[model samples]
Target chain A: MSLQPLACIIPPDLLAAVAREADATQRQALLDTLQLDQSFRVVRAENAARTVETTRALTPRVGAGTPSRSIYDQKHSTATTPGTLARSEGQAPVADVSVNQAYDNFGYTYKLYWDIFHRDSIDDQGLPIEGLVHFGANYDNAFWDGAGHMFFGDGDGQMLTDTTKGIDVVGHELTHGVTQHEANLTYSGQSGALNESVSDVFGSLVKQYHLGQDVATADWLIGADIVGPQLAPALRSMKAPGTANHYDNQPATMDGYVHTTSDNGGVHTNSGIPNHAFYVIATTIGGNAWEAAGQIWYDTLVDPRLRPNATFSKFAALTLRSARTRYGASSNEAAAVKTGWDEVKVRVR
Target chain B: MNLPGSTGDPSGLPDPAHPRDMSDAGLHVTYRRSGGIAGLDLVAECAGSDLPQDHARVARDLLDAPADEPGRGGTEREAAVVPAGADRFTYTVHITDGTRHRTLTWSEGAVPSAAEPLLASLGGLATPQRAP
Candidate 1:
């Protein structure tokens, strides 16, 4: 809920994907802007530090639903923020789904921490859930800066909706902080991709639990709500990784056509392989996603063995090892874990 | 966000053997289908569109294409409900922030009748000079 305290280290690809196919010069300009944005992020962090010094507010809370209390919504663009005068403690917004969606997403994510994980908000220090719904000029995607905050982009409306439409997205973005706090996975190549996959795994589990949807009903896709109706429906699909989204001029394969450009070495696209792996593991386990499958992935995410830029194969091995370690070597969960990885074309020793 | 069917490229071909009307490569229509439905990959050559992209336009339209939709067949889910070739269809908006290229597809239809108002609230895509 406070200002940015950490780095806004998004691999250039996310920004690249945001600016796919831009001309060479324009692309470079955008990249420069991104770098500038990062520097600006530093400035924002300094500001947050100043605010903390002035207010000394450690616990983030909501006053009125309309006027979002989280620092994330300051200077927000949508009517969703409602822009209330200030936090009015316990006041609900009557204007839009934006406020309610923020309220619910924050509540669900907070509960996941407090109950399931026994942690607090994104920071694990009861950090306020700074949520900015409808971010950017109809942008798509949600992000959690190292600084204790979250922002959601309203989809262009064809494939995606508001990035905040899904609880898992919020959880996924917030968990990015968790990953940074724990593994600090470098934002590119295999490790960065693994970092992204971990967030997807945890994010999906959060959605599954909140919706009470069993693995059977849950659709395994990231940013399911962000895509426009005309384009691909899935930003990423798990059951069929490459099957997510393919349209006119968009290549669906991962090896070559998938994004492997500069920014963080395509963490988002490479993550598909692992996301598919997790889907298989949960399906093979034949129960709730948060059960053994969730436990195994969660353990690996926090395991000291996980290293930055660890390739998909390495992480797969780690999951296999973690599952065996967490739930006895002979456990069905472990077998399912192995099978899941195998199905994803990941073979372990 | 009504997952309209009219949004995606309408000429997605399942059978390449069938020669498509290949006058324009850019306007070749494609469609996002439903999960249970089988897709048709038609060899569609686009025709009709002839516009060149500028630096600013490319940057804005780069990510203009829609992100992947959920529940399968991309934009086809929304297309299924609309009358064939209905005005309610999928459209692609290529935007360039003068830096990165983004393609966004515009699809409108049956997101969930309840979502009509919300979709409108999200607003339409920015108009830009299309790439020739």
Candidate 2:
């Protein structure tokens, strides 16, 4: 059979004209080729923009506190990390949507910390943020690898989708690095649950700040976008714990604390208790969550009084102290914090 | 074919609570994965004869390997400590072959290179377990 001319060489207008006169099968083929060609043009444009942004990223900055971010493609292998650098700080979007999302989310998280808390990166030392995406084949998880890097997996498409698609998921993983630098909360028992809760709190705040959403407008659902057909809605809901999905067993109050050794003493399950407290506090304070409720939580995270093994009650007390210290003893913020703990059945001294 | 005394549940997964410890028997492997952002508990199992030949060999070798074998990417101390990152999965594997049996557990960060393929294969078969 004689070879047909390459579709890439044909103009779209000519292709459309030819398709109109062709048989049904040939017409469908031409249409698919045209769509593919259009996608290639879009990708080419994105690559050009990426080149410009990469150049800008390489230029020296006047400020020292700017975020230094890098994203890597794992190529569906879990053998090693920080695999192939796909993008860097200030770089334009790349062909891979996952890389672009990770890069943008990192910037959002950095902006929140710097603009609101004046904290530099995860370490407050302007440490570089590294993210790895497409980790493992059909991998369904994301994590902070204690070693200062973040890893995300392409979900199995049944229960979970792309982990990088969720901005809060990115924030949640990165907050683990923040927690590491500060409280370094032990990842077991109440302390472990507290660690998980802190990540959720800041993760939700990052989403809220990025969207410019107030407490009333925010959905307060974590992993909402990442979930798939098998698990709908979300992984967890700070506003109403235990109601996010079929498997969500999060308890909204200390009275319902789960007693188990699995999942690091049910860290993800029991985090609902503290997560609800933060939600209540933020909603009660009646404004932008990051401005008041977030501030108190952030203060407690970095406070010297916050121990590595802090319990729910201990963390509650510290939040009350933080609110009082920052917003005055009689301020509504402190009272809101106190009320949050009380509602969660966590007695603060 | 099922093992001589095989009593797997309807899904072919051996009962977790009453796993057989028979000596000089066919290969049996059980894998449990937990944690992650969704906080799911997933488990899978397969008899050696049911697995691909290469996977069965690897599973048998894993059962024969020493728990403290070097080059597994993590020491005993590291295994005991909580991994630094959030929403990462923790894995546990139990393997049994003729005259050999071993159980190994590790977080995502400490997974051995040799276990990757086997884990991936088994993870594909995993089903979420309802909370007890």
Candidate 3:
């Protein structure tokens, strides 16, 4: 009488076989039970598949503390990412210069995170670093696809050129992946600006670390090497924010915050506020930017208190907290953090 | 509309009573690309007659399609709500056919396949401009 027991004990195939020989009423019940059991099997299979996918996504593809990098060439087409494998981990340089730049820069970024922060790759799980170069003809931009890949454009030979030439640009895009795996900041409005600023911070740090430059020697410019004649100088200036180029409209302080519908509510424009703050903190600390200053920012990035929708004020306060937590309350690092935010007119309580 | 080679008419016979309006056939398109890593704004404007016949057709078909079409990316509301990607270009395309006008905005990768040629054509014509 109990269909539950029948559904559980009898396999759907056996239940169907039994239904063929049963009485009409019994056969109807058996068929219904078989249908229910079949649905359960589908649900179970789907759940199992989902579990496997989640595990696979979280599982590190390479060994801990080692970077697994792959560089692909798009071959002047926007059709597919990572179009063809031009280089792989521990492989010799290829014929194409862009491929080699991407490969080397990816390694540089990995070294910075690993050597300084002692963190594994982006996800702290040895997530494979994938780079796609030569995407589209004269494409003029570089970006993280938000799905575990970095794409670099060849540039229009006017406003920008050879995006792979900027090591900071590579670090910047890859840091977007790091941010994606961390706070996963909402890429709009104030939080979006924070996301951009974080990228700029780590990006400059990567360059600084590679060059063995102290805060004073570091250029603190985002895309210095990549800009062409049309948009000369650099893409952005963390030290001076709005002075990168003629078209650079970044604002260094809260008083100059630009409110607009374009550029995802001025993410790139307003990021100058935090970018300058980092610049001030690094200079105020007066040593390698990647030392104490970089540690605090990285600490704030992975801190649980840093929310996805964090505003500039929220992020500033968390950085202060990170500074104090890492250093004593009266430590110079914490004081520098406070002074940096105050200089940028961000009130961190 | 009636024409000697017309195949759109439900009847097999050519009808002269409803001639296609030549004025309405003209298309005006404005393309703007913004929000790249360099934060450059580039703009280009063109008339349907200026583009190749195939590209003009694709532009017209893209403008005619509904915003919710699968290949049209997504509705404007959705596009505005979801973040596309970091440092990726955002494109705004406006098309006008006589009195009929439609505008579409999409992040780089979400653009409709049909609009690729039109965008490629316009991108070549684009000049650097500041965002308004």
Candidate 4:
């Protein structure tokens, strides 16, 4: 079966709380909103399945009126495929800015792996990408499924505009598939949380490289553009998770933590810890995340010793070792990892 | 040697748990009675073992008596949980202790899920139940 983003990742409460509105007018509005979302999921899924994968579908096949920045919607049930459920450059392909952004983001992703990693595709085996954009027309949020594709939902004018409004989010979803293949990290508890963190690290790095933004200039805010005015929080904040979102939720740092099943073992929330760790590491070294920080993290992921259910401590140790192994015992790469861990208060011990 | 016989429904299926046993993960039935069976024999060939100890001693004397032993003519059985993966099936055959009159069962490799109910047919086994 194709990948299905779990019900847990995006809590039903957002929709439920809206549905419970006492005002009759508000309730009807919420129902209409939710109905639109469900419909998009169905359509997006049909698209992902129709094509072998997203990148391949894009390759050599310029669709009729393909949005310069088009959004797709993949309707999936769980994590299982080469997933890319949806895409959108901006507002809509008709909207010049949106289309241009979407096309550029999509193109950059294809280019990044082909040039730097020399990976033919997501799977390094010519695996296809499946993306769904403008999901629900105004639904909020975007996610990558083990289903092997991604799905992007437009924000409700208040929370988020469109998932593809940003390139980092796109990279974030694709990176989930990468993490799945390399570590197959169990999607629960701490391991699951790390899975999310890894996605953010790579996702942000992709954007950094594309924009030529350095460690200091990068906003380090994941999904800042994705969130709309009405929403309190963006999808997640790597710099300071809880702070970015409107909710008084704790920061993604380990010291200010929330342990619950709210976000798939807090994959979205807790990912902040390791994300911040990488940010600190990249910022400390003063360059691209893909260089030292991304390489060490990526190398650790493919390490044979990595298990399906590894926590932050376990992952930190692995990165430390990988930095030393790749750059040498006392190289700056290794020291940056040490400092990175120190900043996160997760001792290299 | 071919061990006298090899014909059966599941003669060479891989064991789900740990294979590498004389019984081929409980699929092969060998004559290992005190009558001096020199080597392992298949269930069908078990009739004329080097020991020639007789089927009753090898089948009944070794395993627990069928709950319906005596007049009822019933067969004994045991069940175990599936290990690790979702697809494979296995069984833990019980051994009967002559002195304590106790039954001890051990887990064996992938057994056909279909073989469960048929195990009851071992009863009235005027013939040997070969490695199926």
DockQ of each: 0.04, 0.19, 0.18, 0.00
Better of 1 and 3 by DockQ: 3
lDDT tens digits, residue span A70-181, model 2: 9999888774557999999877899999999899888888889888887878887788999999887777788888888898888878788999989899999989999999
Candidate 1 chain A weakest ten by summed lDDT: A248-257
True contacts kept of 2: 0.51
lDDT of prediction 4: 0.52
Query: By lDDT, highest first, what's the ranking?
Result: 3, 2, 1, 4
- lDDT string, candidate 4, A201-234, tens digits: 7777778888888887887877666766644345
**Candidate models: Cα lDDT each:** 0.52, 0.80, 0.81, 0.52
- The predicted structure with the larger TM-score, 2 or 3, is 3
Per-residue CA lDDT of candidate 3, range B8-114, in tens? Answer: 22232323543322343579888777787887777888787666567677777877888678867543446675455698777777888877777777777776667
Which model is ahead, 2 or 3, in terms of lDDT?
3
For A189-254, candidate 1 gives per-residue lDDT tens digits of: 567667767877887778778888789999876656555664456555667665655632212223
Q: Give me the candidate number with maximum lDDT.
A: 3
Q: Backbone clashes in each candidate structure, one number apiece?
A: 101, 1, 0, 59
Q: Where is the poorest 10-residue window by lDDT in model 4 chain A?
A: A76-85
> Between 1 and 3, whose lDDT is larger?
3
Clashing pairs in 3: none
